[model samples]
Target: MVATGKKLSLDLRVIELHTQTKLAGYIKLLQNNMRKLFFGSKINGVMALYC
Candidate 1:
């Protein structure tokens, strides 16, 4: 039972790590889209079609 408790703790740590990484990736993607919108594309296009 002690070993199983340890395993559960480790699993929770891994899940938290994955969630953080996923959030970071999402933020980076949003930044990229904002750059595209300001540089060459219009907000209309970016917001409507994601191009």
Candidate 2:
């Protein structure tokens, strides 16, 4: 019974780690897209001002 419990706990931990990694990857992608959008808007504004 103890061994089974331990195995279950390990499985849960692995699943948690996988979920966290996936979430982190998605967050990084969102941050990168946001950064690009921010810079793009700034560049557009500058161009508009110059024109």
Candidate with top lDDT is 2
TM-score of candidate 1 against the unseen true structure: 0.73
Q: Tell me the TM-score of each prediction against the true structure.
A: 0.73, 0.88
Q: How big is the positional error of residue 43 in model 2, measured in Å on the Cα after superposition?
A: 0.8
> Per-residue CA lDDT of candidate 2, range 1-51, in tens?
999999999999999999999999999999999999999999999999999
Question: How many backbone collisions does model 1 have?
Answer: 0
Candidate 1 lDDT, 1-51, residue by residue in tens: 999999999999999999999999999999998898676656576667864
Model 2 regions lying over 4 Å from their true place = none
Of candidate 1, the 10-residue stretch with the lowest lDDT total is 39-48
Cα lDDT computed for each candidate against the true fold: 0.89, 1.00
Leading candidate by TM-score: 2
